[model samples]
Target: MEHEDAVGRRVYGTDHDDPSPGPRPGRIYRELLGGPLDGQLFDVTDWMPEDLFTGALLLAPLGMYGPGGRADYGPHEDDPFGPWIWGGDTP
Candidate 1:
């Protein structure tokens, strides 16, 4: 899981993280395999961490249903139209 970035710094562990209590095997499989969401959501709770970018990207679509359920892009909203360039000029 190691890679050299454009600037030559080594990057690793795109899939690795500090482990938590993780799922009780077979729970996630059953959930995605057409089970119910009752116990399903808790299954992978331990695997995910509090990452800003990844969390935002993942939850933005699902409308995050927790204490932060209200945080979401509106369903009728249009995609952002401009490049998010910083400290630079576009020509």
Candidate 2:
């Protein structure tokens, strides 16, 4: 089953992608499916068309680490609707 936040934005969990609820009507969201951010939703509805986001996504480090470190996630097989897989952390 899928869930929605207080204002009705979809919130996908780590082990719940049933495709039954499907995506929200006009929302552009991606799923993170591994590493530190497994099962998290990434909302990209406001991104510009030419941002060139096909490369690795750098997120804040999850565990104890120094500053300027990040976790990486790469696009999974070029799926337009994505579930980006984790690539590890750089510290």
Consecutive 10-residue window with the lowest summed lDDT within model 2: 1-10
In candidate 1 the C-alpha lDDT for residue 6 amounts to 16
Question: For model 1, what is the error of residue 29's alpha carbon versus the real structure, in angstroms, after optimal superposition?
Answer: 11
Clashes of 2: 0
Kindly list the per-residue Cα lDDT of model 2 for residues 17-57, writing each as its tens digit: 65433355566666667776666666556666444256345
Predicted model with the maximum TM-score:
2
Q: Estimate every model's Cα lDDT from 0 to 1.
A: 0.21, 0.54
- Model 1 lDDT on a 0 to 1 scale: 0.21
Name the regions of candidate 2 deviating beyond 4 angstroms: 1-25, 48-56, 63-68, 78-80
What are the C-alpha RMSDs, in order, of all predicted structures? 16.8, 7.7
TM-score versus the correct structure, for each prediction: 0.13, 0.54
Please tell me which predicted candidate would have the highest lDDT against the true structure: 2
TM-score of 1: 0.13
Which lDDT tens digits does candidate 1 get at residues 1-91? 1111112221111122524323333332111111111121212223333221121111211233433222221111132221111111111
- For candidate 1, the per-residue lDDT at 44 reads 28
